[model samples]
Target: MTKEEAPVLLEVRGLAAKAGSAQILKGIDFTVRAGEVHAIMGPNGSGKSTLSKVLAGHPAYEVTAGTARFDGQDLLAMAAEDRARAGFFLSFQYPVEVPGVANAQFLRLAYNSIQGARGRDELDPLEFDDYVREKMKLLEMAPAFLDRSLNTGFSGGEKKRNEILQMALLEPRLAFLDETDSGLDIDALRVVANGVNTLRNDDNAVVLVTHYQRLLNYIVPDYVHVMDGGRLVKTGGKELAIELEARGYDWIQKSAA
Candidate 1:
């Protein structure tokens, strides 16, 4: 398909997921197109994170039914690593720390892995260093961060920024940011938002799973969806988020009830 005729980047039809015997997502349906930023906002335990994991093919959660298509390809059929190499990036809310791995080395390995999967020439350390340094500047991260162990002693904000750094490096076609602004301060929030803004292009889209409207203020979404009881209860533009913020979710809960 040409750029104009390219299918939706993401299309979920009656998607349901379960963790062990417990059902988390119940018949969720949504479609995201290129050049769009879609925000999924809801109260706690509303299956926001579950949706992200299921899309990225997390093994612990089983996709009980329904279908998810990414750029006209079957996403569920792809392996987790294959999904990443195929341009699916997930920014975890809680980034893990590696005790002895240097941040630079980890990034180089990830970049090279993606390149290898795409059948592109792998860059040596020297080549990758220059590429990653340019990305770090886009994130406003210091050069010193490259030498430190991955999130070993970094602050919460630092870890989130590091996640964005990975996103920038990977440059996925579709990015799922699960609660990226969870523990960020004002300054860090701005930095992270800026990085996301810079990455926004007509060729990619972002699915932002968030709880607060504050983050929306920074990276405005074209569509805002409210999920409840494992299903999407409402969808609208940025104003919907403001409305929900102004009038708590009680009305939506009552309406659903």
Candidate 2:
């Protein structure tokens, strides 16, 4: 058929989560097929980030109920690192800074770890340098970026670009980007969006979690899912994002009601 009709990469059903006593992600059901880009938008406290973290298998939240399958494997059963090795990636909303780790060193370690997990020989430092630099070119990052401590002293746009670089190098099958557009200017947004678009293919999928539709303008999604009251209230095409931009999320809650 078509790339748009590619097989499923992620299937999440009846997903419920809780952070200690607080209930979040009451019941999230979504499907991400290979070659599809899905955007999840909602207001604050709506559990968008929570769902991303839960799927990534973060220890802070417990999966009280439900199931997720990544390429036919039980996703919830895998550890966070295993999830990454299994081609599941989550880009944090707040990419943290590492004080002592060189960016190149960190990226190489992460890349090699995934390769080792997949039963492949790790790339030597010299080999990885050439490989990583090629991926950096996709984000227009400078060679000096590899020398700095990871994310330390990086501008907001720089950190986001660094995250995209990780996504590019690892080449995960499914990626969940949380608020990647936050704190980015128009030009940076376009660059980051273009980098993500370049990585799109019939074997991977992207789920973007954001609060604004501005990013959607750069990276158009095949589906837009509205989140409210800890669940998905609506699903539509790219036009849904424009509608939310014009009318705000209240319009979705009202429409869902």
Candidate 3:
């Protein structure tokens, strides 16, 4: 397809999602194009995380209405693993710890699994190790980390870096970062942001979900969206985040109402 005819990377149209009987996302619509960064900001319980989970195909979330399209394909119809294999990646706010799986091994397994699904050859352990080492260097991660269990006993900053390392290796077409900067110190935040900035290219896009404007100071998203009460209420550019930081959510709530 020509660049103009190239499918949109991500499109959400009137999406409604729920957990059990309680609705968490109500008729949300947005789109992300190649080489763009979009930030979604909202107060607690505004359904930001629920949107990410629903896009990633979490079983606990039911899509009660509307549709999500990724690369011109039906996103909600795909299984969770299939979503990942189809070039969707999510960096969770709380990464899990697998005690027995060495970090390097886990990375290899994840990388190879995606490659296998795409009909690409899997990398051997040695090749994969070398590959990941290069990616870790971008994050300034130590060689010793490769031998440790995944996220086991890691510091908050370390866990965040580990998540970026996976993102770099996967080289996803679109990445969803859910509250990635929540617990990091200033220095750690810069490190993680640098890693994210480095990975951005014309072929990929990022959607960052955050509650604080501090993270936006570093990543500098091209567009900012405000969400409240399980719906997207407003959208603007980088300046919108500054406005919200200065005025807080009260003004946004009033305007939406």
Give the top-scoring candidate (TM-score).
2
Per-candidate local distance difference test: 0.92, 0.93, 0.93
**What would the TM-score be for candidate 2 when compared with the true structure?**
0.97
Ranking by TM-score: 2, 3, 1
Native RMSD of candidate 1 (Å):
1.9
* Residue 126 displacement (Å), model 2: 1.5
Report the C-alpha displacement of residue 23, candidate 1, in angstroms.
0.5
Residues forming the 10-long window of minimal summed lDDT in candidate 2: 1-10
Per residue, candidate 2 scores C-alpha lDDT tens digits across 165-217 of: 99998889999999999989988999999999999988899999999999998
Put the candidates in lDDT order, highest first.
2, 3, 1
Model 1 agreement with the true structure over 1-257: per-residue lDDT tens digits: 44446458989999999999999999999998888899999999999999999999889999989998888889999999999998999999888999899999999999989989888988899998899999999878999999999899999889999999999988899999999998899988999999999999988999999999989999999999999999999999999999999997888888888
Report the lDDT tens digits of candidate 3 across residue range 1-257.
43345447999999998999999898999988888889999999999999998999989999999989999889899999999999999998889999989999999999999999899999999999888899999999999999999999999889989999999999899999999998899998998999999999888899999998999999999899999999989999999999999999999999899
Clashing pairs in 3: none
